[model samples]
Target: MCSWMVSSYFGSILYSEMPFNVEIKAKVSNASQLAEKASQLSQSEGTVIHQQDTFFNCSLGRLKLRDLMDGNGQLIFYERPDCGGPKLSNYSISNTPDPEGLRAVLADALGVKGKVKKERRLFLVGQTRVHLDTVEGLGHFMELEVVLKEDQSLEEGEVIARSLMKDLGVREDSLVTGAYMDLLLEAQG
Candidate 1:
């Protein structure tokens, strides 16, 4: 049987200044197959991204510096439900051209929590992004992030997310709550 991890306390911090969304995270048994299926149904072929997310220790919310292999990065702060299914996530993101410098500052200010490295195949279906991930040491996982506009409702996003979940053959039973960093932390403990 597959194991699951709940969201950490730090996972529940969102900047009030940012956008909100209905996000779903699940374990994928066959990520390549799912990606193939998604390519057939999606508007375009997904883009592949290799990313290293270094999480920091924070009292309020989850903070991570995401350094993409392309030299672009983002400082992400987020809050979301820790339950094992589709849920609401609030987050703020700031783009950074200097990831190494920021990483040093963050590490000095807040100790490193952990880091997660993954090769992500991201497909866009409407406003939602379907992620097929191969995470280092952790194996495969899938994520659905349905971005909600100012005019959009959480219920609407949830409906879209659920429908996409079905289209992607994502099993509700395989759903996981929390971020990848949280999963790594849980594995350590």
Candidate 2:
């Protein structure tokens, strides 16, 4: 079990204890084509969401405030390897009714690292969530997150993630190793 603490800048924060997932991210050459395949596989049109993610500097792991832009948001802290292909991510989330106020507190206390704004089309395929993201300044990408049950092993999650990647026509060569923030920071330099 990983142990960490977040300050009570936001009152009544919800916490999930060490939930993990096996996930992959890839650069999408054709957004519409991938969206069609994802929709077909899931048998439903995905939900469209606009997100503004503000990353804060943290000594351990990566912390970000995800503003859903619909009066709801999540403060997420996650730790995962910065490598290509399917990898395990251990994370926790806290829901907030007032994201703007929380963002201000976190930004001031931690200092801002960067921000990523994107339009995401989210699909549910079995136990997995397929995200078709159009990221500002970074183009389109597809992410597959296989949410692992408590009894599930990491290999099982990886198998599921790889299968979804194959189903979505995500090539190994197109796989990206890091978050959109890393890409944006690199582009600025």
State each model's CA lDDT, in order.
0.83, 0.88
- TM per candidate comes to 0.90, 0.91
Candidate 2, residue 66: Cα displacement in angstroms equals: 0.6
Q: When superposed on Cα atoms, how far off is each prediction in RMSD? A: 4.5, 6.2
Error of 1 at 129 (Å): 0.7
lDDT by residue for model 2 over 133-188, one digit each (tens)? 99999999999999998889767888898888888899999999889999999999
Please report the candidate that would top TM-score against the real structure: 2
Worst-scoring 10-residue span by lDDT in model 1? 1-10
Residue 102, model 2: Cα distance from true site in angstroms? 0.5
Candidate 2 segments exceeding 4 Å error: 1-16
